[model samples]
Target chain A: AQSVTQPDIHITVSEGASLELRCNYSYGATPYLFWYVQSPGQGLQLLLKYFSGDTLVQGIKGFEAEFKRSQSSFNLRKPSVHWSDAAEYFCAVGAQDYGQNFVFGPGTRLSVLP
Target chain B: DAMVIQNPRYQVTQFGKPVTLSCSQTLNHNVMYWYQQKSSQAPKLLFHYYDKDFNNEADTPDNFQSRRPNTSFCFLDIRSPGLGDAAMYLCATDQGGGNQPQHFGDGTRLSIL
Candidate 1:
């Protein structure tokens, strides 16, 4: 079964501080990985995705993620986080097949302190 | 601009009552999906429509049904919404069947009374 795991359940960071959220996955083959952000009462917004080629991918809102094959990890990072960046982040894995089978990990709640 | 849009941003219903949520997309994507997301948890795939074909997740309950009248519109109907069904219902669209990035709507928060 393909599954994703985000180790941190909740994280608190000071505004303008660096942030890193770890994600790990288990799949039979190379899977498509993605990061999504969700604010209160809003749907998810795609942050970035890793299909192939470049292991490091940049996304909107000054976010980037590195997909490490050996560690089966796709960790999200930002040089600095803003107060508005406080939200729920999710890591998802999908098999490259006919039917859409996207599996999302338990979200990590991020809280930014000014 | 919002590509995917879900109506009734907030919906409240009585237990065991039937309720329907609607989603529309301007992307004209071939695939549409419905997901259930509870508080403090990840979103779970309920079903999806690839064109006119319908695909339901194996673990999805019988109470949950979906309809895609056309390429641009889709509906999710819960025959008997339980208290546990009180959660955010998200609708997403993609270009094709496989590994494509999806565009999500603001979602409808369904509250069961």
Candidate 2:
């Protein structure tokens, strides 16, 4: 079974400040990783995803993540964040079992200050 | 165009009442998933369907059930609404493969009174 761990429960950062959200996964083989953001009263929106090749992957809304096999991590990063960026972020790991079922982390809540 | 559409952005149901939420996708993906997200928690996968094939999570309680009659339509049925079941129900669709991204609908905010 595959699982994801997001150490940070809540993160607060000022506007224009850089941010990094840590995510680690436990899986037997190479897994597909994804980052999703959900605002209040809304469903999740895909921030980015990493399947293979190119350790660094770019996503919408000025977001990026690096897939490090050695570290077993795919941390989401942004150089500058807007107040609208404040939301709950989730890290997910997908495996090749039962038609690519994904296991998700608890989630990290981000609060951006003005 | 709306790739995924969930009817009744907000839904309120009485305790022990049965409620059904509908999800329709324009993407026409073969795979559709239903997730339950509580306050300050990650979205938990309740079940999913690959075309007409239904798959439910082991931990999913009997109170929760799902049905997908066609390729583009799916429904999440809550037999007996409980306070714990009150949460935002998200509908997502993928191309039935790992390489494709899972697109999500706006979700239905289910409130149990």
Candidate 3:
């Protein structure tokens, strides 16, 4: 079974500061990874996804992530963050051939300070 | 824009009362999924329909049932609600292709009293 681990349960960063949210996965084969953001009282919005090819993927709202195969990690990074960027971040892993399922990490709550 | 839509942004039902949440999508994706998300938690998959084929999670309680009458619509029916059932019910759609992304609805907040 594939599982995800997000080391940080909650992260607080000052506005305009750079940020990085860590995500690690346990999968036997090459896995498809994704990053999503959910604001309070709202559904999730896809930040980006990694299928194959480029190890580095770019996402919306000035966000990006790199897939390190050997490390089994895909971490989200941003050079600077805004107050509106505060939300919950989730990293998910799935396989193209697997059943329509994505094992999601517990999630990381992001709070931006002014 | 083509998107997923869940009716009744907020629903309040009494305990033991039966409630149903409906989802419709303009994207016409073959796969539709229902997920439950509690406060400060990740979305938990309840079940999904793949071109009318219903797939329920192993641990999903029997009280939670789902129906997909056609391609564009799906419904989540709770036979008897409990406090634990109170959460945000979300609907999402996928193209049923490898590496395809799932689009989500705004979700319905169910409050059991």
Best by lDDT: 1
Top-TM-score structure, candidate number: 3
- Estimate, for each residue in B1-103, the C-alpha lDDT of model 2 and write its tens digit: 8599998899999999999999999998989999998889988899999889899988999999999988989999999999999999999998776556789
Descending-DockQ candidate ranking: 1, 2, 3
lDDT against the true structure, per candidate, is: 0.94, 0.92, 0.93
Q: In CAPRI terms, where does candidate 2 land?
A: medium
- For candidate 3, the docking band is medium
Candidate 1: regions farther than 4 A off = none
The number of clashing residue pairs in each candidate reads 0, 0, 0
Question: Interface root mean square deviation of every model, in Å?
Answer: 1.3, 1.7, 1.7
Interface DockQ of each model? 0.75, 0.68, 0.63
Off by over 4 Å in 3: none
Task: Please state the error at residue A70 of candidate 2 in Å.
Answer: 0.5
Candidate 1, B1-113: lDDT as tens digits = 64999999999999999999999999989999999999898998999998998998999999999999999899999999999999999999988744788889999999999
Instruction: List per-model TM-scores for chain B.
Output: 0.96, 0.97, 0.98
Candidate 1 reaches a DockQ of: 0.75
